[model samples]
Target: MKRVVVGLSGGVDSSVAAYLLQEQGYEVIGLFMKNWHDDSVTISNECPWLEDSNDALLVAEKLGIPFQTVDLSEQYKERIVDYMFNEYEKGRTPNPDVLCNREIKFDVFMKIALSLGADYVATGHYCRKGILEKDGEEVYQLLAGVDGNKDQSYFLCQLSQEQLAKSLFPIGELTKPQVREIAARMELVTAEKKDSQGLCFIGKVRLPEFLQQQLQPKEGLIFEVDADSPVYHQEQPTFASQEEELAYLSKNIAYTPELGKVVGKHQGAHYFTIGQRKGLNVGGTKEPLFIIATDVTSNTIYTGQGNNHPGLFKKALFIQQPEVHWIREDLKLKAGEKMEVMARIRYRQPLQKATLFQFEDGMYVLFEEPQSAITEGQFVSWHIGEELVGSGVIS
Candidate 1:
């Protein structure tokens, strides 16, 4: 019998996944990865890890499968937690789920499963994998789940070809409702458990609250820009030239339109991010203000009318790491190479059409029709049809 280790998170999806694999005649082992603790930081009420693990154990018992819990708290902190803190410190949003899927589930957990003589390590992820003959060699292809609404290919993009080969996603073909029904049929303990949301480990805690516990919130100035100010006439340069312009434009950018006066200061430029619409205390404008630029060195924040040019919402994004899975042979791509592929900048964002280009210095560029908020330190995943090729962090 083929031994399969199922990553049981004490959720309905995972419980059903174990049931499905066992029904398919694979010898299933329920492996609960203890990734986080309740004592160190505040955890979401929904994700009671202890209760979840116990529930997973009950499900395993019901199915007559062996169950074990692996304490991966240290590995989770080093790989996921530290990475998240570092990204936020750099003023860029990082996807912890992506890192968790890559470093923890595939890398660490897979190793443990393999050591236990398991033929495959399975998860409740809403993704699929297939084998393809590329360049006379068998290659693993990562596919989006059949249920588009629950597809999690974005988070699984960083998975390596070897990892994909051994990973099984039993719930890939089933919709959320179907998975719930399967759990109900099995009479699993987690049949009615709600899905876990928010950060991968921390759960639904607000970003500010989580950050405050890990990082000191430095009081910074918040700059308010006037609508009629000359700064609006200034051309916003690309991210590369932002530093120089921010230094020159900081003082001149904040002109109050209603009072015809400047008001409020902001913290450093590196402190803010793009697409931020809240936390700016510059009062006076009836329209909602959006942060367009940040001058980290000068400690200034530039605001613009919420409804500016649609061009500001960029469609094209550049990526660095490109992992082509379904393609059999290595593709030699160059700059300006436009291929119709689906790309995603964040986990929650939907996949959109884009062209990929191999730029100089290991950097890859993704060109979408309209520009996107291609923030630095964010992961951009690529897909061809249903197969996930690879992903890289936006520079």
Candidate 2:
């Protein structure tokens, strides 16, 4: 029998994953990873690790599998928590889920499982993995799950080929409702439990509040662009000659000065992100105000009211570190090559059409239709049809 280690998060999805694997005649062992908890003294609704471990133990008992809890709290803090703080400090919007999967799930957890003599490690992630033959060599391909609403390929994009080869996702082919049905059939304790939300271990705490606990409040100003001040460039020009003039004006128009008007006084520029509207007190605007830019050096926040024009959204975005999982070794794609692809800017957003342009400095510029809220420090996942190609951190 093939020995498999299942990452049980004390949730219905993972519980069902272990159940299905055991039914397939695999020798399964349940492993719950204990990440971290906020120790700086604040009320948190985070999942108590003890409670989750107990729940996982109950599920393991029902499945007749050996269970063990690995305390990865230190690793989680170093890789995930510290990385999050550093990103926010740099005024970049970092995705903790990506780091969690790359550093913790695959790196730390996988190594631990392999050391225990398990042939493969499994998770409840809604992603499919399959081997493909390329140039007489077998390579792993990560595919989007069948459940469109619950597909988690975005978070799993940072996974390398080797990780995918030894990883198993038993629930990838099943929809959310189908998984729930199986959980109900098995009478798993977490069948009716609500899905986990917010940060990995922090549960349901609002991001801003959580940040306040870790970071010091530094006062900064928020700037709102004044309509009467000046029309730097108008999308529709009055005359043919003015069209050329408008183009030049648009190119030179500075967004930094405008952002300084709306953010009257903020704690810190790192505390906010582009496209955020809530908590911004740039009152007296008829339409809702959205954060268009942040000048960290000048300590300014820029706000734009009314609908964001298509031109304001850029078709191209640069990524700092691109991690690609190619099936073939010799498929060297050159820079400026326009390849048809799909991408997602945020976790919950739907995938959209894009073209990848490789840069000289190992970076990639994704050209797409003006995507809204293309904020720096966030992740952009790439896909070729239904298969995840690669992902990178927006620079």
Candidate 3:
């Protein structure tokens, strides 16, 4: 029997995953990942690591599988926590969940499992894997889960072909409700447990408080730019090439203190993100204000009056060549090539129609319609049908 290592995450999905793999006659071992230990910033009663680890152990015992816990806190801090601090410091938002799956789970944890003679590492992610034959070679495809509402293909967007080859997602074929039912029938400890929130391994945290631990608060001014500002009324320029036109469209609008009036003060510019609406503490506006831009260097945050503000929408976005990642290397676009694909800037966002243009320097994704708050340091994933072909960090 082939030996498989399952990352039992102390949740119904993972519990069911382990049980299903056992039913398939594979020799399964359960390993709960202890990636976070600092609970100072984590909220109370919010999927604490100790509770989660215990639940994972119970599930493994009930499944009659050998189980253990892997302490990956150090690796998680280096690969994920440090990166997040650096990104936020530079006024960019980073997705820790995506980084966690790529840097820790698939890379570090997979190596540990392989060292133990395991044939594959499995998780409870709501995404499917498919195999295709091309030129007598086996190709792995990262397909969306069968459950539309719970599809999590976006989180695994950075996974490489090699990682996908050794990975298994057992619960991808079932909906959330179906998985819950199966766990209930099996009388699993996590059967009625609520899903974990906030960070991947870290529980729900008071974000501002957490960031404050390292990123000390500095008072910053919040300026509210009007919807009819002259900044948004710039005349379109004729471009000599398509790349030139795209470069203009993809660029972020530079905000200045002179462009708007001071509305309020924020604890820190680094704590705010584009499209964020809460924590402003500024009231009495006709419509709620949303963050449109943040300049950490100047410690200034620019806000717009409403969601449909012009500053919030962009027609295109650029990705530096080094940041581009292709799961299906065979389908990668060459310089000067372009392809029509469905793409999303953030997780669970409805796929939007976009065209990817590859250049000598980088790639540009031009959407058919304007998209809101295309933040930097976030991943943009493109899909060809159900298969996620490529992803890149937004520039």
Which candidate number would show the highest lDDT if scored against the true structure? 3
Model 2 lDDT tens row, 175-287 = 99999999889888878877887677555656777777677778887777754444434574455643233233223135656323543678788888888888886677788
Q: Where is model 2 more than 4 Å wrong at Cα?
A: 39-46, 226-254, 258-263, 306-312, 321-332, 363-368
lDDT-best of 1 and 3: 3
True lDDT of residue 21, candidate 1: 95
Tens-digit per-residue lDDT, 248-354, candidate 3: 99998999999999999999999999999999999999999999999999999999998999989999999999999999999999999999999999998999999
Candidates 2 and 3 compared: the better one by TM-score is 3
For model 3, the superposed segments whose C-alpha errors exceed 4 Å read: none
lDDT-better candidate, 1 vs 2? 2
C-alpha positional error of residue 24 in candidate 2 after TM-score superposition, expressed in Å: 0.9
Candidate 3 total steric clashes: 0
TM-scores, all candidates, are 0.84, 0.88, 0.99
lDDT of 3 at 35: 93
Where does the lowest 10-residue lDDT sum fall in candidate 1?
Answer: 245-254
